[model samples]
Target: MQSTPATTTTKYPDKPITVIVPFSAGGGLDLTARSLEKLAPKYLGQPLIVVNKPGGAGAIGWGELAGASPDGYTVGITGIDMLLLPLYGSAKYDYPTALTPIAQVAASPMVLAVQANKPWQTLDDLIKYAKKNPGELKFGHGGVGSFPHLLGEMFGQAASITIEQVPFSGAGEATAALLGGHVQLSFVNPMVVKEHMKNGTVRVLAVTGEQRISDPVLAQVPTFKEQGLDVILTNWYGVAVPKEMPVQVKNKLSEGFKAIITDPEFVKSMSNVGLKVEYLGPQESQTKWLADSQKLTKTLQDTGVLEKIKSQRK
Candidate 1:
């Protein structure tokens, strides 16, 4: 069960603030929350306590956040999934409307990876093989309607190719499948395959987002656009509280979170874990939320992927 936030006092956050992680411990968001925990007291006047509420593909933790009191002490970690889950029946609340965005902290760049022993040396190499044998090359992803899966389908459209989709329980499983030669390709987090690449078991071909990753080693990999495929997909993380807070309280919380996320130490902490800290304030974050929501919705609807996700949730 989820724990309740401390009671609201005459002043905001008279007690510790709760930052919820929808996923289990040891994941990217968990690392992010732990970093914030160390930095919160200096900024927010109170420490942040992290609570794990994993289940239902993030619907559980986010749902709890949306239902939290709008008293400025019940914010939680958010992601691109926050906007996508409501489109399906999995989530009862729309994150954009139900919660107030505080700041965008980090993003995970997607990469196209293949087993090292495979014949693909570059994005072009993989494209040529896929064109030669349409629907013969299979790629693994977190699941249907997931960012990695959606990116895979969109890539085929942009590159004018037909490849098979093989969904897994999550990106970790999908990456394992790639390493074991169960699939020809996988769109996974760059960090997930970094160690495998070092061990000469995986070869990353191209990145999906506009920029290369911030990691010095991963930054060398060219983006999809550089390789002639104009596809951009990003998995971003942020902090948000329930909506309709007093204006002053909202601003205070927002500014505090911004300070913590952009601090030099916070930046270094995120960098060590393969996350890039890109801080966007409340207004800018909301603009991005609406833009991403529209773009992804159109992509899913056009490709009939939206209906598949809706059906799966039902």
Candidate 2:
């Protein structure tokens, strides 16, 4: 009798990998996903197909990502929302462990911005005025419980000021509200205020990063700490897969993403949009995800936002 030949398993990533982007098609996350797709064939040896799953304020997409099979084929972009949904008690799964961050791809810190036409030439001016006027000043944010909103609350707490928060559908609307003077202030992306910085339309008083940002336009902005308020929160995006993929497969995907993000062309593309190519490997990425989630939980609790979110869910 002839000996039977042994079967061989297929190599990891032999086919296209699907990356779910839980937002609209034209947003910054979508742009980053598509931009990475351009370099995937070279670095990943397979294409990355980005699927938009926009809804539920990112809950719909994040839910899908958390539920995706543990196989390496399906991954998704995870960020602040992924970490916050579970805390809000709206998530279908516990984000802290259900998903594993493969790597962090990009980041952009929020800036404390006011219309240049306003009287607050500096953060001090804004804080002092808010103190004197109490809740007279209003600020617009992407949405309730969003990073911008929570960061705004944190800032208010740190500065010992009282201000009203206006929640919009998203950052774009909030930025527009700021520009139209519907709100006296806003926590906006450095990029959102970048163009206006040139014409002196929007004045960025401080950035929400531990250190200053690198964008020529935004670098001039001091950090919250530098300005005497220790409030800091960064908007970051990273690729995440279910926490149960094969170790080798996870490592391979991490390597691919790292290569794509580090590519000079990719770096340049991100820079052009005023986003930094902030890369962290799989282990480091997962650690950062966990840390950010924990920190946000504390911030929310301290600012009464945790209870606020819980109360709203009912």
Candidate 3:
């Protein structure tokens, strides 16, 4: 047999890059990804494309990105649900661990909101009613096992009530459902519900974070803990590639994204849409992802969902 020469691959961004947004167009994640798209080519010297792969509560698109070649040409935009999906057996691929953390783009915690005409004025009122009539009240989310889903479960546990859970595709849909009286409440990120809230279509009850969000629309709403509920959660969105991506490619993507996140125009755009600006480079993102995942896993284990998921996997 004749000896053959070894083949070497060229550097990334050698051609067009595809950035996948695992949600519908016009949503918070899609908007941020598109905003980054405008500035990324300036930094990387190559054309970037935004592809929407919305379904399965972001699992369908995430799986597509996971199976893509680890050449750094394919990347994805994901949110907090990426951390909770697998624990509920919804994701087709393991997140956090399967995706290489390039850098965080933006993050915002979920806020509990009710229909404008609903009688429950405060978080306490809602809890009291739910306890009196367990499972009579419904709370909506982006989808089953999403951030809102977990938040609903946690609140139910804390309040000692049974809350009927309703899942939608995104916050837009969830907002619509809440307004249309399909559901009584939702724990949605303020970014997605800002417009409806401004018009008084939906009423915010309380924020789910440790501190109250700075948005003027939510200035009156208090944190869940401040209302006597110890529950705390955050919704963060970030960009990532396959875990096996080249280090140089990851570094370039991280620097570009971090730069875009801190850009004056980008920050303004995100803030206008109610997204809080918080940039986490690769190392910090990885550390947080691991720690958050551990916390979520423990929650699942306590709920008996982890063993249920493993049994289904087997």
| lDDT value, candidate 2, whole model | 0.83
RMSD of each: 4.5, 4.6, 5.5
Candidate 3 lDDT, tens digit per residue, 1-314?
Answer: 44546559665566778999887786677877877787776777677799998777789889998889988789898787788777676777788778888888787778888887888877888888988887899888776666677787777777778888777887668777888899998887788777888897888888888888898887778988888876687878888898888778788888777877888887888888888878998899899898888888777666554564457547
Ranking by TM-score: 3, 2, 1
Residue 99, candidate 2: alpha-carbon lDDT: 86
Predicted candidate 2 versus true structure: per-residue lDDT over 1-314, tens digit per residue: 44546549776777899989876665566767888889999988889999988765577777888788888889888768678878888778887788888889988788889999988888999988998899999989866677788888889889999889888766677888899999999887786678888898989999999899877878778999998887888888889888788889988988999999999999988887788888989888878887888898888888888887678658
lDDT of 3 at 61: 85
What number of clashing residue pairs does each candidate have, in the order they appear?
Answer: 0, 0, 0
Per TM-score, the best of the predicted structures is: 3
TM-scores of all predicted structures: 0.84, 0.87, 0.89
Pairs with backbone N, CA or C atoms under 3 Å apart (clashes), candidate 2: none
lDDT score at residue 200, model 2, on the 0-100 scale? 89
lDDT of 1 by residue, 184-225 (tens): 998877766777877889888899888887677677889998
| Superposed Cα deviation of residue 94, candidate 2 (Å) | 1.2
How high a TM-score does candidate 1 get?
0.84
Off by over 4 Å in 3: 1-15, 303-314
lDDT of each: 0.83, 0.83, 0.80
List ranges where model 1 is wrong by over 4 Å: 1-11, 131-138, 180-184, 311-314
